[model samples]
Target: MPARILFIDDDPAGREVALFNLRKAGHEVTSAADGREGLAAFAAAPFDLVITDLKMPGIPGMEVLRKVRAHSPEVPVLVITAFGNVETAVAAMREGAYDFIGKPFHREQLLLSVGKALERRRLAAEVRDLRVRASGVGREIVCASDAMRRLLTIADRVAATDATVLITGESGTGKEVIARRIHVRSPRAEGPFVAVNCAAIPGELLESELFGHARGAFTGAVRDRAGRFRQASGGTLFLDEVAEIPAALQGKLLRALQEKTVDAVGADAPVPVDARIVAATNRDLPERIRAGAFREDLYYRLNVVDLHVPPLRERPADVAPLARRFISELAPGREIAVPPEVTAELERRPWPGNVRELRNACERMVVLCRGDAVSLEELPPLPRAAGERGGEEAQDWPPLPAEGFSLVDLEKRVIERALRLTGGNITQAAAYLRIPRHILVYRLEKYGIRRDG
Candidate 1:
């Protein structure tokens, strides 16, 4: 197929040759006097391939290669170098140039390289499309609330471009689901959809996990690993709990977003990445920035297109439909009936844990309910069980000891009980107490309690 090609060379003779040959071959060619002019043209529009000379005034071919790779890694770049500078051309290839031709190259040779590059691009696109179809990553979003519908419509509109998007919401509000919908409707639907939960990984390991590592770069580095950025090339990368990214790595992350490249650990070059970033976080990033936990500049870079997913309680109109959807998904072939009363009860409860809690409740109802229909009795207890344990029917509190109990000792005992109930899992214990894991760890150390006990 004919392709759009950008040719950049300082020499007038080189430009004439490229334009004459490439245009004659039925390919649309844009010629630039130098690398600077070439880069400007590239930024103005899209091109299938870039051909430039290694030596140029104002900006060199290698710099052009880096910029082009950073802007669009999928576009193949071919470098023309001096006969003795084949080493430099090879280095350019390592930096993501598709191929290189030495000085005084024949027209046939250039055309051949261009043809091969375009063919490779076509094959790669086909593979991505096949992978997307096989994985079925394009999930159907279920929502009934006007707020949600508006949000999704806006999301779909933004999906057409390469803008960065930041999704903000309470945990379990399905921010990732919205991100997936954007990917599915996007021009890059055929490409990979890579997701990284920043909070799940430790601070020290996250850098290597994101930027990759050369073999033996660290103690456990047994092999060279392609980082998330590279792995998501020509696709979308969803970074969940983006606020959890450490402050030290924030600068590097900002640079990656800015330059569209990543510096792998112990690697010589910054690998260009073409992945669209869609980050989500439950925490208020502005508050974190005020408290010095997150970088301000990085937040601005991520917030180019901000999307806020309202909590389940805020969108009560959607509760019934969501519950029904969950029931159908969980029950599969079985015809499960969710009565109006049961749905009313579900909508009445303030779902603090949001959609996730509702899904769990639906699952429980499906598993415990008799026959095909659900009853009011099968519904989960109301949030906080206030009706059961409060008001006039509340039981009396335990009497204080004659000498009074030690408050510190009481706190310690509560922490130990939480740890025991969770089988000595800090994360679970913290969740049970509705506190951060770090705070729980601090309490464990302050009280001298064993973590596994």
Candidate 2:
């Protein structure tokens, strides 16, 4: 429940009834005999939520809502109205009233309205917080592709609060890297970051690693020790491979997340700790949840913010820039040249490992191709997804893909090829396809094409 609710109504009976019901619902309630009193009360103290009747004397309900919205956009304003006041309620929404309850509303209706209103206010605050964090100092995850940019935009909003983040990508897709990005971009950046791999820790020791243990808690315990949560106090806790969390430990984990406190093994007291949670997993959590291996509630809590990193095969356009960037730093005398054909072949092959795989390719090229130039012969195995034009866009290719080839996997390969041919130039690719830059970008992102060198 919110800390306080202010009720405004001209009728003494209505005002008294609203105040009584709200107070009974466990809210600290204050009644206003009129809109003027409501506005005055609003000016004097902080209120989590405000409920006002539409037809009020002195200032009027609409005016009161306007002033409240202007002064405190984060606070929720709920308007109450008669049966035929639907139009007025619609206007109130435009004027920034969070929600409405009719005069003859049932007990649940009133309570639900207030609850939803408070929730809206909470979301607003969280969005604001995320905005601030998103603007924090760090090299932005730079990418010209619309999909990646869109994901980052969503990430900014997700980083604002303690909402659990679930980053999904194939192996080497940089999931953990993005998780750290969120952590550092969050308000809890100053807090310690403790990363736990559900897959790395032995199942038997998983619980101990997460929640800690009391002295003599187990045979191996020589002394009591603080756990990851305590270690990550006032910071963010990242759980990689979250889908691997065991069923037995899942319930305890859910409880700890809900309560923001942990009870170590063999300990009677629950120790409170403040830590923002950011969880990452490569597995399909929804599938795991359906298989009964993962708790549904815990999955929902952790999936509040989800980011899926497209495979290296999908974002081929990122390959070349990343590769050149990777190779340039390693190359002596400052400049390393990228051969167009090598990049073409790089774009042709499906990179199962995403960015991590591309980085390895660049490193290999740097080591093997000692000269400033790298050729297709020195590149890794290539895919035939690109080089299939003929105005068909996709079809007219040979039947039966070679070993490790998939028809369903052409998007990233083709986009990567187009980007490489276009010389890391987005406008050139759009021109080649005779499509708008935005549309081309959309296609590149949709296919997950990262340029390769």
Candidate 3:
């Protein structure tokens, strides 16, 4: 089939010859005098393939290749190098160039390379589409709040482009869920959706886990294996808790994002990757950057489009619908009604754990309810709010009972409540209680409170 091609060369004569031959071969071709003009032409419209000379005046071919791969990895890039630069051609391939041809190439050679590259891309797209159809992964975003609706609208709009996205919110605010929604709505919906929790993996082994490792790279490395980058090729890669990525490996991650290539541990050559990055984090990345923990350049690369998920407390309207959805999920075949009082109590309580906590509460009610309707008694105890007295309003502070509470006991309870509200994030919990993070850690240890609780 004839393809739409972008031909870029600094030499006017060389470009004319290639353009003439491509048009004669029944292809729609656009000509650019240099790399910058070629990129601008590509941005204006989509093309099937890109052909550029290795050396150019404005932007070098190698730099252009990296930019192309970073922005649209699906597009195949063919480099036109000098006659004796086979080594440079191989290096370009490592940097995600599809193929390289020497200068003074024949018309047939150009046509053959173009044909094969397009065919490979078509086959890959077909396989991806088939896999997505077979999986049938679907989830409805049950939301009634205006904040949530606006967020969804933004997500849908960004999903059409290939820009990297950064999702930020407190823990348990359903960041991963939002990431998945974007992926499902995107043009790459048919591609694989691979997720990795950066915090879940230890810092020492995170590099290998993300970029893969060859055989005998480490103690447990018995055989060569592809990592999340390769596994998510032609798709999306969700890096949950991305703020937790160690500082030492930040540079490598930045390089991979810039070059669209990953060097596996113990591998001689870097592998090309086409996965779109959608990173999520509960921690404040700007703070981390100020503290010298994260790379600012990488932050800019990943934050091409930022999506912030509002907490459950901020979007009270979504509570009832989310509860109803969870109830249906927990009791698939059975019909169960949540009483008005139970839902009222759910909304009244400050949900520190956000959507995740609400889902857990619904599960508990379903398992414990003996009748068709769920009541207030079936609901779990709500987390205690700081500075509250028993059965009294906010104005009635420190309303001690006839049997007064112990000072230590009260402190422990307050600490636990703060921890619960922040989803066990010590730094956030301390800020909520107007204390230092170290103090919160000490109290947690003193009271035997588990961080994961």
Candidate 4:
């Protein structure tokens, strides 16, 4: 493929010569007079490679390199400097410049460097795509509601670019699924899709898990291990439960995102990585930030493009279809039908567990159903408010003790019931108890209620 090159030089003669040579070499070329013009052109439309003169009247090449690195670290930058300025060129390389050429360089030298840089980029992208395909890390997105359709549309639009995406929703709302969908539909679809659950790994080990480690880096060091970031190079890294990442690791995570590099444990230098980040979290990050648990800057970096998933209850129209899909997936060979009554019942309760809870319910019904058609009896017990007997007629709430019960115990029980009813969705549980979501989170932490539980 013919690469697109952006050549920025204050010397019109030098610029024209380079432009003409690149064009003759079968490459598309765009010329800019200075660093400012080059940046403006880049912002208007990104190029495959950027070539800028080291000494510009305004916005020096070094400044341009910094600006480009800050915005798009994946883009390769090559500096053009005069003879005896080798030190400056080396400094540029240290600051993320791909390579540098002398002002009086021959045509072949220019062509050779450009070709090498473009080839490196091409190979990296190809490697990423192959890894993703070989790993089989993609799936079809199942959605029916207009709200969901709209969300999918937005996801599709953003997938074509390399923008960072932050997915937010209650637990079991399929945030990771949506992230995968975006990756599969993106230009880097062929690249690997690596997922890491920030909440699943222990806080102490998360850094090593994410950034890899050299042999003997820690107590159990058996051999060198590449971290999730390296494994996900040239692809997408899905960070699930991002809010749960420990405070100490937030700075390192921020640095990686900013510089497109990771310092492996026990390594001498930072290694460059080229993976797109798609982070998902059910917890309220803003509340966490207020509590001084999450870094505000890291939150901003991850939230570059936000995708909020609507809970199952909020999108009632998708419930039956999702339930049917789950049933088919769980009981492939069996002939089973989800009756209208079952679908109606499924939609009536607040599915705090979101799609996951509904899927589990469907699986249970499919396995236990005695006939082809599912009946109300086979379905799981509904929430008190949505039960067949209705909340007024139910005796589920415990009676007050003769010697007054502990308020703390009562509070814990109520929160547990709410979580059970909602399928572990803190947002829905909080709503059921008429308390703020943050307060519910505090209670969950206080009582050690696992979000997954």
Candidate 5:
């Protein structure tokens, strides 16, 4: 496939020669006079491949390669070294250059390297697409709202690095989907993605489940098990509901993360493991930490980069798109339309269960709709009833005191009630009150509300 290429060299003759050959081979080539100019062009626009001279006037090729990789790790960079400078070219490769060519190289050799680099890029894209497709219903992320779009932009940027990510959101918000997306987009895409639900496993078995167990280690250990960490070798290990990990195991988990090694049950020595950590939770870790349920050190270890997925009720723009996608996926082989009224209704309701609830509602619509298109009546009755109940509550507020009522007192009481209902979680309390979190924080400060735990 043809691609956009950037060729940078201080030598005018060399730059022109490479530019002419790359353009002649059907690629759109951008020529940069030096490393600084080349980096500027790269930052300004997108390019599939970058060819930079190793020895430049102001900025050297090594620094350019490092900057390009830091900016976009997936884009391949080819280093151009002077003849007999093979060692420097190899060093460039170590710094993440795709491949290098000698100063007085053959056109065919340069073209071959460019073709291979582009081909690799193409294959990586295909792999990501295939992975998303293969992951069945409820596994895909639909970012129709600006909030979700911004979150995904951050996710993509972080996916380029090997940072430990902690995803926080209400349950059923597709944290696992985000983790899988990161794994597929990272350099470790080809490796296995091992996911372990920390909440589901019992405390007694959780350690073994995470770090494996040697044969005869326990009653059920008939065979040696290579736990989730080992299974995710060279890839990502997603620790779902990480906040649920027992306090006793938090120190061990912290050690494992810090040391990059695991000591299996009944194992004499610690085994080094290579797996990127990505954890998720719906619980409030800070509250838990203050309450003595979660350890602060372990929390820091898992929360190197935080990504918060907004609830469906907060990102109403996603409701229609997500519902449509779920309907299509659930009702495959049929042309089912989601009518405008149904879409409007979906956007209006508060999806307390987030994406999972919307998907379930879509499945119901797909299975129960009588006509080709969905009708408002086909929506799940419970969600509709919930919406109606909410509306009714809003309309049917308690009668005000007969004489005089203090609006300030009522507002303070309501905010306190919201905080109590959400267990003092500012974010959830704000969502419950249908207000921005900052606004809620301001109210808390104004009222002198004790928000800590």
Candidate 6:
């Protein structure tokens, strides 16, 4: 594809040079003299790439970066900065900048960064394609961790078919990532894989979102829309947190699933659809079905194949690799070498929040630590459940449940109490908890524990 380019800078000379080189490279180019104008230009059309100066009058390059991401998130962004302003470049990369070039940068480097960013976007799309094939019908895994492993095995088997698969897992166990992996392994490797979170959208408007609305469907429906089902046509429609879908809308969803057609909001007829379906949830759908909270027929239809992702605590062996992958992705600027002590701490600790907790820890260590090697002393401590971290006063509140009140909850409370005990000093809390500082911060968020801001 011939790429479109946006060049933004306050300096007229700089913008001209960028426009000249990019156009020479055969890309269609657009120029903006300032950040505000640059943003306006981007909003006006879809551009394949954007190269913006770090500093500009009015809105800065950072704000420009934010705007471009908001409008065209997948489009590549390259930052231009002065040689000594490496800090700004690093910040941009942390915020997902594809790459950067110093002020006196080589023409080769600029072109190379732009090319590589586009390639990365291409690769990400390709990966999504491949994952869909990998997880498609006839590829689902089968096992018997009683109800659990058996469920995953069923998913492994169903992944080979084109049936709609519903996956259930806790919040942080990576339910959707599993969905992508399934898609990559499935026959739909060549199709686009689109995902939407049901819980994130409002109950009142979710149907319109799933099914596109007409220009006058309702208030603020200014344009005719194509809902997710149509968008995922010939691909997979992944609905995360499927239980959050409203009861009233379940019948409509069922009709679409049964008939392979969707009637858009305010429209009179149903449009044909060719998308495969894969829904996920953190809630217990069977229980919901029993309680009449979720439609039984819809549950059966979606649960044609069910995959249950194992929690981090259940599979601690995978934590290190998962964490490393996340660290490499999230902390690309910081070449953080995981020290043995840090790795050991990561393993010894219980990750109630699973992969999400590990990612947060990596981000914290990258932000707080000064060097390439992450140290155990830099990790945060585990959280306290209920009132355990406070004192004997915790006992006065309530006895532990027969099943043992959630360790996740107690860990959060404990971390908070420790932070208070140490007066918000992370290092102090780490020492008191007898765990590495990085691990402590990970647990703090896992348990919803936060030091007083």
User: Which ten residues in a row are the worst by lDDT in model 5?
Assistant: 381-390
Each model's Cα RMSD: 9.6, 17.3, 9.9, 9.3, 11.8, 19.9
TM-score between candidate 3 and the true structure: 0.62
Which 10 successive residues of model 4 have the least lDDT summed?
384-393
> In candidate 5, what are the lDDT values of residues 15-113, reduced to their tens digit?
888888888999999999988899999989989999899899999989999999988887999898988887897888889888988878788998999
C-alpha TM-scores of all predictions: 0.63, 0.55, 0.62, 0.62, 0.68, 0.54
Question: Which clashing pairs does model 4 show?
Answer: 128-191, 129-190, 129-191, 132-191, 132-192, 352-422
Best-matching candidate per TM-score: 5
Q: Per-residue lDDT for 1-453 in model 1, tens only?
A: 789999999989877987899999999999999999999999998899999998999999999999999878788999999888868988999999999987888999999999999998889778766776677877777899999999999999999788999999987788999999889777788788999988767788889989999999889899999999999998899998899898999999999999999999988889899999999988889999999999999999999999999998899999999988999999989999888888888888877667877887788789897798988878766534324555543564333578888888877877886665554556557778997655677788888998534
Per-residue C-alpha lDDT of model 2 across residues 199-275, encoded as one tens digit per residue? 65667788989999999998979999898988989888889878878799999999898899999999999999898
**TM-score, ranked from best to worst:** 5, 1, 3, 4, 2, 6
Model 6 sits at a Cα RMSD from the real structure of: 19.9
- For residue 434, model 3's alpha carbon misses the true position, in angstroms, by 15
For model 2, the run of ten residues with the poorest summed lDDT: 135-144
- 1-453 per-residue lDDT for model 4 (tens digits): 689889999998998899999999999999999999999999998689999898999899999989988876667899999999989999999999999999887999999999989988888778766776676777666778999999999999999789999999988888988999898878668778899988767778899999999998889988998999999988899999898798999999999999999999999899999999999988789999999999999999999999999988899999988888888888878878888888888889787688878876786688788778788887777655556554653765566768887889888877887777776666667777987565677678888876534
| Residue 46, candidate 1: alpha-carbon lDDT | 84
lDDT values of the candidates?
0.86, 0.76, 0.86, 0.86, 0.84, 0.76
- How badly does each model clash, as a count of residue pairs? 0, 22, 0, 6, 0, 56
Clashing pairs for predicted structure model 1, backbone only? none
What would the C-alpha RMSD of candidate 1 be, to one decimal place?
9.6
Cα deviation of 309 in candidate 4 (Å)? 0.4
Q: How accurate is candidate 4 locally (lDDT)?
A: 0.86
Off by over 4 Å in 1: 1-131, 385-453
